[model samples]
Every structure is written in structure tokens, then in C-alpha cells.
Target: MSTLSLRGIVRQFGPLRVIHGIDLDIAQGEFVVFVGPSGCGKSTLLRIIAGLDQPNGGQITIDGRDVTGTRAAERGLAMVFQSYALYPHMTVRQNLAFGLENQRMAKEEVARRVAEAARMLQIEHLLARKPGQLSGGQRQRVAIGRTVTREPGIFLFDEPLSNLDAELRVQMRVELTALHKRLQATMIYVTHDQTEAMTMADRIVVLRAGRIEQQGSPLELYNRPANKFVAGFIGSPRMNFLDGQAVGGRSVAFEGLPNLDIPAARETTEGEAVTLGVRPEHLAFTDGAGLPGTVDIVEQMGGESYIYVTLANEARLTVRRPGQTQLHAGEPVRVAIDGAAHLFGRGDDEHAITPRRLP
Candidate 1:
């Protein structure tokens, strides 16, 4: 089994501490993604796990064995980096066999792995060609094939699709997902794109600065974010936030909207400052009791439209509706928070004081 565990992991570069007492456990054969913005130490943490970088403290273990002092080559892991680090002069077959040769593995076995990896990645036709002769996607497949031949216990991917174009990235994502299931290997991926993390990961570890803010399934984080950072980061188009005061028992008082009796899973003390969160799809134009705003922009995205509004308090809020929209800029409208609403303590790192956590 390829289970991984990191306990009280800490890292520093001279006097500057980057990772701070991190603790995480990854199950065998699970696809775990580490996601955060740049400088968030995702790549640094991945390197530490891969044994490319040593942590200042804590222990790293694989399958119950303490591997904190193990060499990267002996740790039984292979990493695919952001750049397709293929040797320019080597053919696909040679590149795939190079690592095996360095390990003094049998030539026949090397040939078998190279052939199998090429076949699995559908790059058999490009096996004889050098890296210069392959397309970007083909090159990436070759890069991954190089790792597949290693047959490592865990597959570590550090933004493996970042170099590809948008369409190619989507294609690679599908390929990688299929490959993971085919091998049933434990995979740890690092990316800044939350959409990528959402679509590919069995578990997502949301990191900010250097610490993990929250870790859960894609829907768990989307529906019940632990804090404001996660609430804004996990969803597409992002969740909108408004400043408000908790009042009238389980209700909120905010500018633009009247005191709303929004149900929060957790009860907050009355008069406590809180923030109201609403996703674009949960909001709509209403004729009844609602917040007044003027339409600022209506973007028709084929079968769906995203309507941007300027509230009376000048806070911008987006409402997403299905199909075409008749709304236009400068049109006065009243928007209703129709769907589930979330409440968070004021500021970025507070937990969901409102909305239901997974049952």
C-alpha cells in the first residue's frame, strides 16, 4: 500500500519559515491535490514529500515506514514536473529507458516497460522520434510515460498540465484521470487552478500562505467551506461576500437588503459582525422583498448568462441565470437570494458560521 503521512512538517529557508507545522495523511490509491495561489508553498511541500527537499523538522512516512531520511531515489516515487523535461537528443524509447538503465535494470525489462508505457499513452507511433519531432501533447505523454516505466509506489505531479494550451490541458486531465485508475496508484497533484483540483482530485487540500486552510472532497469544500478564503477560492466565478451584522437571532442585517432571516448551521451571538456569502447561481432577479440594484453587465455565455449588478451600497454582485437574459445595463432590478446562503465570521480565515456542513 502507498499510504503517505506527514506529521508536524516544518520547512524554512534561512530565517524565513515557509511551512509551519503541517500534518496530513493520504490514503492508499487516493488522488489528492494540493492547491493554492503562487508562493503558497504547494510545490515546496510536494518536493519535501518527494524527498527532493528536506523538511526542517517532522517525519515523512510511506506505508508505516519512517522515510524522513531516505534518499529520493530509494523512496519509490516518481514526479512529473510542470515542464516536460525530456532530453532533446533522446528518442521517446531512449528517454523512457534511461532511468531504468541507471538503476541497472534488465534491458529486456526496460524494453517491455517502454513498449507498455508507449502503448498505454498511445505514443507508440512517436517512439522513434526525438522530443523535437513531437507535438506538445505528445511530448507530455512521453514525459508521463517516462515516469510510468519507473513503476513507483506513488505518482507525484507538480502542475503537469501548466505548459499546455487550454484545450490540450483539458485533454491531458482526462488522460491523467484514466491513467490513475488504470494503475490504481496513489497520486498527489499540485496546481494553482481550483477547477483542475475540483475535477481531478478525490481530496483537495486548500493551502494559503503555507498552512492548509481546509481539506475535503470537492463538493464538501464547495457546499460547506470552512472559511472565507475557501468559500471564495473553491467555486468557479467565486462566491460573493457582503458585510453584515448578525441580528434578530439567526438573521443578518446588511446594507442593500432588509434584515434577512438566513439560517446558519451554527448560531452566532446577536450583533456580531458577520459576512454573508451567496453564489451567483443562488441569486436571481425578484419582484418581491429583495435587494435593489442596477444591472451593470449581462454576459451571455451561450446557454447560460452571468448578470452583474451594482447594489445601492456600490458592492458588486453577480447573478447567474440559465439561458438568455433580457436584462441590460442601467436597468433597475431587485435581486433575491433564492438559493442556500452561507455565513462566515468577518475576514478571510473564519469558518462557516452559517450554512450546513456535510451530514
Candidate 2:
């Protein structure tokens, strides 16, 4: 386990600045995940940490050592790439032993490490098989085992599960989480998958436009997003944002719905535009008047259903309902926003209109 810190990290390609000046601190043995959409610099940041890509500026320290210029090999970090970069000619045992051999470890010690890693990954029986003979899941485990035998101070994963099937991805995610707990190694994983980040990370770092939009525990980010972008980004099915205007203090009227309660502190200069942010799961199909809409789509998932409603103003909202509601397309539906639903200053997209101070 080791701590990592990045100070004023910057990465640029010619005049195109991809990673803005960023600073972050990662605790020893912490499982941190970097997640964002495509071209968001999550992978670039991970590469910088692994010493694969040199930052245009800033300092990177690992375990109290300023390893900013250290070679990837000397950084004492092992990286698991998305491609499962196993040698085609080598057996699983050989692949696991390769790194130890490069370091001139004794044959007996190398064998011992390989055996231990295989057992840890529950793939001891697959040792004699080549990469071609292994399934995708097995291959991924081998890739991870290859890193494990190195006994690296830090482990870096770069979308290592992107290549697997959906079911396999979920299964591998569980295995990886368990492995992290057992090893208690400092892990920094980069992925575009929110489900992966939400489920696996002790802390999730949300990135956008080369900046750290927000960083927090999964639930914290989910329940109390810092801004509109985060509110929409963190949740499954996404949060719905509708055009609204603060009519007066502590009240905001939706364009096509009744006035909903706003935090008293929400700045409401006459006709000040704002966006009302409500999450699908936080909303309920109510009997009383709420946001009136027509059900546009219904997705049934056995025990639950997702009702996608399109408001008269053209804004779409998704609501999670219990079991299968006899909802069909064009059915009249009303979704009551949880009073605590977020409101944000429309143009700036940062100001949270909800009560800044919680009771």
C-alpha cells in the first residue's frame, strides 16, 4: 500500500490542453476510481500516474518519493491494460513469472509468487494453459495475476474490463473488489463505466473538460451533487433538468408544472433563470397534481419499471416505479419531485439553489 499525490498536473498536446492544472491526494491502500465520458482525460491521468505518459508540468509523488521523472519500471507500480497484454507464446504460469524473472528474482521465489497469485485469483489450475486456451474472464484474471506477482506498491487499471461481456464484466468487477480488499493495495482505476466506479470505488473522481468536476463517495455524489453537470452525470438514467424561473424567495415555478419549494437561500432575482434537477429514483408517481406528462416509454425489469415521461415543455423525465405499473405509451402520468430535488442557476450551472445549510 502506498500514497500518491499529484500537484499542478498538466498535460498538453501542442496548443490543445487536454488536462488542466489538477491536484489530487490519494491515501495509502485506498481504492480510488477515475470516471468520465470519452476524451475526458481519465486515461491520460492514469497514464501519468503509471509513468507511461510524462506530464507537461507538475509533480507526482508515490509513497513519499518524488517520482515525477521516474521510469514506469522504477516507479514500483504495475499496470493492467485493457487489452490483457499477455504474451501469446507463454503459459499462464510463465506470464505471471515474467516480471519477477526480469527483476532477477530467484527461481524458487518467482515460482512461489506465481503460485500465490494464481491461488489469490483462483486460477491455479489454469497455470499450464496459454492465453489462447483461456476464456476472456480467465485471460483478464491472468492479466491481473501478472500484476499481482510483481508485488507492486501501487496497482493501476486502465479500463481493464472494457473488453469483457456484460455478465463477465459484472463478475470481474466483484472479483476485483474482493482482490483489492484482500491485498489492500493502493489501486487507481480509470473507466468510463459509472456502474464500475459507483460500485467499486471508495472515492470517485468525476472529470469533465480536463477538470475535476467533483470528488466524493458514490452516495455523496449521487445524493448531493455539487452542480448540474454532476447531478446529471452521477446517477443511472440521469437526473432530469427542466427550465424554470425563481418566481420568488423559496419558490420556483416549472415551465409546465406547479411551483415547487426551493431553498430560502436560492437567489431569485425577478425572472432569474434556473434549472430544476430531479432524479428518477427520487421521484414518485403521485395521485396529486405534480409535473404532468405523458408516459412515452415503459421499461420493465422484473421487480421494477422505468417510466419515461415527456413533459409538455419537451423535457424528458424518467421515474422508477415498483413492479410493473399498467403504464403504456401516451398514458397521463404525474411525477412528484422530492422536495429536496436540486435547483441550479441555469447559465453558470454551478450554483445549487437548494438550502446550502442543511437543518
Candidate 3:
């Protein structure tokens, strides 16, 4: 296990700056995941950590040592890329032993390491097969096994499951988490998929533009997002935002919906413009008064249903309802808030009022 710290990390391409002054500390044996949209510099940041790409500025340290100038080979880290970069001509056994042999390790030690890695990865039976003969998941396992044979201080994964099918991706997620538990090595993973980050990481780092939006446990970010972007980004159905004005100390007045008093932990201004963020799972069809909208569409997805409702002001709202629903298109629906909600100010000014913690 290894600890890492990054200070004032900066990256630029000509005049366009991507990463700006990122300072982060990663503890020993923790699995940290970097998540963001495309072109958000997640991969670039991972590369900088791996010493594959030199940063335009800042420092990288590992285990109390200044390793900013260290080469990738000496960084004590192994990285698995998205493409499962396997040598097609070589069998799995040769591929796993290649790096150890290049270091001139004894043939006995290399063989032992390869055997152990193959056993750990459950690829012992497939050791004689070449990359071209393996399935996508099997090839990925071989790629990971190649890294495991080296036994570096930290393991880095760059969207290593993006190529697999949905079922395979889920299966690999469980396998990778189990692998992390067994190895207990420090890991830094970069992925565009938030689901992957949520499930596999001990902590998730959310990036936007070039800066760190927030970093915390998955439930921490989901339950108490630091800002509007994060509140909207981390969840599956994406929190719905309604433009409204703060009124009556803790209440917000929207045009179509009734004046809703928020359970705010902080005081709200009397007439400040605010956006009310509510998750689809937090809403439900109400028998009494609620947000009046017309059901635009209903997606019956076996165990659950997704209801798309168009509010009176033409804003689209999605409500995730558990189990089957008889509701169809063009039906009138009144949705009420039943769970968590957030409030934000205009122009992404953090949370206008932080919500109260639920019992």
C-alpha cells in the first residue's frame, strides 16, 4: 500500500488550460475513483499520476517522497488501460511473465509469480490461449493479471470495463471490487461512468471544467452535494431543478407549484432567486395537491417505471416509481415530494440553503 499527494497540479495545452491547481491526498490502500464528463481531464490527471504525461506545473509525491521527476517505470505503479493492451501473438502465460522477464527476474520466480497471478485471477486454465482467442472479459482479466504479476505499490485503471457488454461490466465490477479487497493495494481509477465510480470506489472525485467539484464517499456526495453541478451529476435520473424565489424564510414560491416550505438547515433570504433540486426517486404521485403536470411518457422497465411528466411551465420532470404503474401518456399526474431535495442559487453559487438531515 502507498499514500499519494498532489499539489497545485496544472495542465495546459497551448492557451487552453484543462487542470487547475488540484490538491489532493490519497491515503494508503484506499480505492479512489476520478469521474467526470468527456474532455474533463480525468484521463490526463491519471496519466500525470502514472508519470506517462508531464504536467505543465505542480508536484507529485508518493509515500513521503518527491517523485515529480521520476519515470513511469520507477513510480511503483501499474496501469491497466481501457483497450486491454495485450500482445496478440503471445499466450496469456508469456504476457504475464513478460515484464518480470524484462527485469531479469529468475525463471523460477517469474513462473511462480505468473502461477500465483493466474490463480488469483482464475485464468490458470486459459494461460495457453492467445489474446485473439479469448473473449472480451477473459482478455481484460489477462490484462489485469499481467499487472498483478508485477505487484506494484498502486494499481491504476483507466475505464478498464468500458468495452464489455452490460452484463459483463456488472460482473467485472464485482470481481474488481473483490480483487481490491484481497490485494488491499492503493488504487486510482478514472472513468466517465458514474455508476462504475459509485460501485467500485472507496471515494469518488468529481471533476468539472478543470477543477475538483467535490470528493467524498459515494453516499456523502449523493446525500449532501456541495453544489448544483454535483447535486445534478451524481444521481442516476438527474435531480430536477425548478426556478423559484425564496419566500417566508424557508419557503420557495414557484409559478406552477404551490409554495413549498423547505427543510433548510440554513436561513433563506426573503426574495432571493433559487433553484429547487428534487430527485425523481424522491417524488411520488399524490392524492392531494402537488406539482401538477401531464404524463408525457411512461417507461415500464419490468421491476420499475419511469414517468416523464411535463409541468405547466413546459419543464420536463422525470419520476421513478417502483413496480408497475397503470399510468399512461397524456394522463394528469400530481407528483409530491417524498424524500430528499436540494436548493441552489443562480449561476452555480453552491447551495443557497443546505437541507436538513433526514431521520
Tens-digit per-residue lDDT, 116-223, candidate 2: 999999899999999999999999999999999999999999999999999999999999999999999999999998999999999999999789999999988887
Model 3, residue 264: what's the lDDT? 68
Candidate 3 lDDT, tens digit per residue, 1-359? 89999999999999999999899999999999999999889999999999999889999999989889789989888989899899889999999999898899999999999999999989999999999999999999999999999998889999999999999999999999999999999999999898998999999999988889999999998988888888888989888888888887867888866787776624677788888888899989998978888999999998999999998778889999999999999999888888987888776556536766433
lDDT of each: 0.90, 0.88, 0.90
Q: Over 4 Å off in model 1, which ranges?
A: 357-359
- Scored by Cα lDDT, where does model 2 land? 0.88
Worst lDDT 10-window in candidate 3? 350-359
Comparing 1 with 2 on TM-score, the higher-scoring candidate is 1
At residue 89, what lDDT does model 1 achieve? 93
* Model 1: worst 10 consecutive residues (lDDT sum): 350-359
lDDT of 1 by residue, 257-341 (tens): 6777777824888788898899999888999888888999989998999999998889899999999999999999998887878
Clashes of each: 0, 0, 0
TM-score of 3: 0.96
